[model samples]
Target: MTTGVTGRLGGIARHARPRGPIETLAEVSVSVESGLASDFRGAVKPGGRGRRQVSLIEAGDWAAAMAETGHSLPWWHRRANLLVEGLDLPKTPGTRLRIGQVVLEITQECDPCSRMEEVAEGLKAALTPDWRGGALARVIAGGVIAVGDTIEIIEG
Candidate 1:
């Protein structure tokens, strides 16, 4: 139950294919059936359980991790789908967040992988604690979303 708090969608990015370069976007369409447009992970599974459809990171958390690792890098290097600011993302699953017309359900923590180290030495370790790596979410309601969109907890 998040109350009296709101966040902003600071940025949006999606990779065309697995391990592909992340493309920064000003706006994009999202769908429960396809997740984010042009994203490699957009396709829904057979059971419609696409928990990792959208990966979100807190801007402050990203900054904290970078400060810890002492490696200055863009947030895209983390390869997250969305950068949310002005609100602290909850660690608990089932927390619902809304960005523009889209509603996302937090499914789990998006664990950091070796790719982070490839992007920056020590990055993986820096993002390891306290859900710094961000959260994995499934799109429950889909629509157009854009940079500067409001991100708010829709349900506890």
Candidate 2:
């Protein structure tokens, strides 16, 4: 599967590169719901939310600055299954994405917290005064996602 953006969405292609070979496939998970800061509690499930999805700005138009930093830890440093390329998700909230069989709706932009600054070097300077970085998405549908799965914009 060609897992990246295509056409006008082709912007994602700019950041994609081959991952080479792997021994086994990885399982992908998404948070059913998410919120910013204090609101995050409400978004979590009874047990707990799973891995958060993220589109690393480094893979997209922001790569220049991100590369210079030599760090994936931006103000919003979170582990995401898919490191999206060529997409600034926080800037464009409400965007819909399809990854494998899962459909995700961008709910709101994820703001950075002091914790991110401590975890990632130079992150404090990378964030805005508000410390915003990327968008938080709600899983509209659930399914398995692999490294090569296509990420398409179903809606803007």
> Which candidate number maximizes TM-score?
1
Clashes of 2: 5
Off by over 4 Å in 2: 1-25, 29-43, 46-58, 61-77, 88-90, 129-132
What lDDT does candidate 2 reach at residue 36?
20
Top-scoring candidate (lDDT): 1
Worst 10 residues of 1 by lDDT: 1-10
lDDT of candidate 1 over 61-145, digit per residue (tens): 8999999989889998899999999998989899998888899999999999998988988999999999999999999999999
Pairs clashing in candidate 1? none
Q: Write the per-residue lDDT of candidate 2 for residues 61-140, one digit (tens) a residue.
A: 23332554577533223322235554444345566778667777666655545654555665545543331345556666
Q: How large is the C-alpha RMSD of every model relative to the true structure? A: 1.0, 9.4
